[model samples]
Each structure stands twice: as C-alpha cells, then as structure tokens.
Target: MSIGAVLAQLRGDFPDVTISKIRFLEAEGLVQPGRTPSGYRQFAAADVERLRFVLAAQRDHYLPLKVIKEQLDAADSGAGPTAALPRPPRRLVPIDAPAENVGLPVADDFTVGKELRLTREELLEQAGIDAPALAELQQYGLVRPGPAGFFDPDAVLVARTVKAMTEFGIEPRHLRAFRAAADREVGLLEQIVTPVYRHRDPEAKSRADEVVRELAALSVTLHTLLVKAGIRGVAGC
Candidate 1:
C-alpha cells in the first residue's frame, strides 16, 4: 500500500504521526519497507503493524528510537518485540475541533495570527531590530508580513535571530539561503500532503493538517539536534 493509505489507517490512533515521522523511523532502521519499481514506497501488512508497534512504544513507553530499533533488530533475529509493545487504545479526536493543538508557540503557522498582530514599528521594537534591518530581512523573504498585512508574533523572534546574526556580519543577503532552504522543505512536505489534502474526504483533510504540523515539528527537532551536534563537535565533546 501507499504511504498515504498507511497514514490514513494509523491516524485514527496516532493523530500526530506524519509521513516524515514514518520516513524518519525508516531512516533510523526501525521499520524498513520495500520500494516499487517506480521508486514509490510499498508497505506490506507487516510493515504497517511494525510501524504501529514503534509508534505505540514511543508514545506509551517514551522509548527512544535507539532502544526501539534494538528491539526491532532483536525481533528480526527471532526475539519478539511484542514483549513491551502495548496496543493501548486512545480516544479519537473530535472531527469538529482543530487538530493542530500540538502545543507549538503562537508564531507557528498552524495557528491564526489575527490577534496580537504587530505593526512595523512594533515588530521592530519587539524583535530588537531597526527599520532598515527589518526591511532587509523582509526583502529577502527571511521574514514576512501576516495575512492581515501585519507582522505575526513570531516575527519578533525572527528579528531577534536576524539582529544577532547581523552582529556577526551576516547580512540579509547571506540569510536568503535559509529562506530558500525553508521553501524547499515546505515544498517537500506539500508534495507528501497535497494528494490527501485535495481529497474530498474530511478525514483526509484532517490527516493532511496533522501531518503538516507533525512534519514541521519534526523538522525543527532535527534542525536543533544537528546544530547542537555541530556545536558539540566544535567544542570537542
């Protein structure tokens, strides 16, 4: 089956799981599915069940992927992962309620920013940046105005980063690469969701929204981990 089919199958229980998360697990050698001749991922019934095991272990036991991968390896070698893999049932989220209450901060794109919309001056002050610097960041797409033509609350944090980077002589033009990378990441995620997103099914739309949120969170987690690892290596840790 396709990844979308697996996602729709598991989303009833694991609402926050995304295709990115599944692919991440696969990368970590937790669950390996086969590939088709056309390069599409093909998941078998066993693949889906193994994924359920991994996600359940993560959510219920808070087991790190390393340990889970070990369990999977053991299972593959004839030791069963069923020892600690509990298939606990979770109550389904109501269809009417928004699915994006993932505890992300206000500036995340998942939430509407109509409230606390900041003007240019307000954004500058909050971000601790001057008007000219703000214009530079805006010009390069490092930051953007909100849907209502005001700055979202997250703009202040973006400005803070920009201001600090400027002190290191990193100009807005130099930061344009970050914006470009972000756009590319967004495109990759959209490709995963667009098929399910455009479907007429309400559940499909909900799954698509949840997948985007989960993927965004996963991306941030990965970025933070890589940066921290780089810093550790630089410090000879």
Candidate 2:
C-alpha cells in the first residue's frame, strides 16, 4: 500500500488525519514504512495498524507521542501490550465546574517539582515542537530557558500549548498580549506581597509565601472565569 492508501484506510476513523500528520509520525519514528527505489512510501498492513494506534492514543488517551512511542517499542519488544497503557489519574471535569480544593492552595502548586532540567532536544521532543517553532516562541517571549541554558517543565507546557494554538491559526506574534498580561498580573501580585515579604520576622516571611500561593491560585481562577464569561458573551451562550 502506498501512503495515500494508508491515509484512506485511517481517515474514516480519524477524520482529522492528514498526509502531513502521517509523515510527521514517520519522522518521529513512531511508524516505519518501506521506501521504494523511487523513494515513495510503501506502507504495510502493520504500518497502518501502528498509525491507528498512535492516532487513537493521542485522541482518546491524550498520551504524548514520546509515551506512545515507548509503549510501541515495549510492545514490539514483546514486553507488554499497548492496551496496558496508563490513563490520566484525575477525573475529566467540565470547564465551568470548580475543581476539588479550589479554595486550598499548596506551595507545590506554585513551584516546579524536583528542579527538572531538559536539554533543547528533550524539550523539543517533550513539547512536540520543532526547532523553528521553539525559536519563534522564544522570539515572542512565550517560552524561554533559564540562565543556565536548561528548560523547565513550564517551558515545555507553554511551547506545547502554543503549538496547539497554532492549529487555530494563532501565531507567536499574536501571543505577545498574553505575555504582557502575565507580566502585569505578576507585577500586581508582587506589590501585594512585597511588604509582607520584607518583614524582619521569619513568621511574616512564611505568611507572605503562603499568601502568594493562595493569591496565585485565586488569580488563575479569576482569569479563567473572566475568559469564560467573555467567550460566552461572544458566543451568545
């Protein structure tokens, strides 16, 4: 079967599947189709099945390609079945619904855990972004590495989110307002915490930290609600 035949076979199940997406999966080494002497892709039945597995894992399970690849590799090695893949632990909740413990904010919620550091290649793979996309994100200040030249988990999240946003025709330059808004919000939060943070008493400093965490949570909630309201108005909901 040619690549086009493979696409036709999967398109009924995955309406959004495209030749480009299939090519990308091949580039990521998730699928290995044979190439003819003319350099045209020659997909086998197993290759089509593998593409289905990858697409279904992404759509139904929200598994990253890296994890999906690992599962595929494990399956190929006869280690385990891909059906044993893990699902996200948390319940899927509606956007309008308040999450559990919305009022209680913990320090862990505000801090990156374990001081994780990833190289550029790792960040790209985890974030599912290419170098040019990453560069554009950095150009817009939407994603940045630390002074030590390593990216944190937050950078990965930002790059991934921006990549998804691009599907709706949103570009990096269009996200500048988001960066500006975040900076302004952080500045305002700082103003409220600076005095408490400066107290000579250690207890005051601790209290300031707690306050910042709580306020950070509230700020995010407020922003989400405001955006929801505005979107509803726009949608006449």
- On TM-score, the leading prediction is 2
What lDDT does candidate 2 reach at residue 36?
97
Those runs of model 1 whose alpha carbons end farther than 4 Å from true positions after fitting are 1-115
Which consecutive 10 residues in model 2 have the weakest lDDT in total?
86-95
User: How well is each residue in 41-116 modelled by candidate 2, as lDDT tens digits?
Assistant: 9999888888988877665554567778888998999996845433323322333445442443323267434878
In candidate 1, what are the lDDT values of residues 145-219, reduced to their tens digit?
977789777888888988888899988899888899889888988998899879997756755665676567666
Q: How does model 2 fare in lDDT?
A: 0.78
What lDDT would each prediction earn against the true structure? 0.75, 0.78
With a 3 Å backbone cut-off (N, CA, C), the pairs that clash in candidate 1 are none
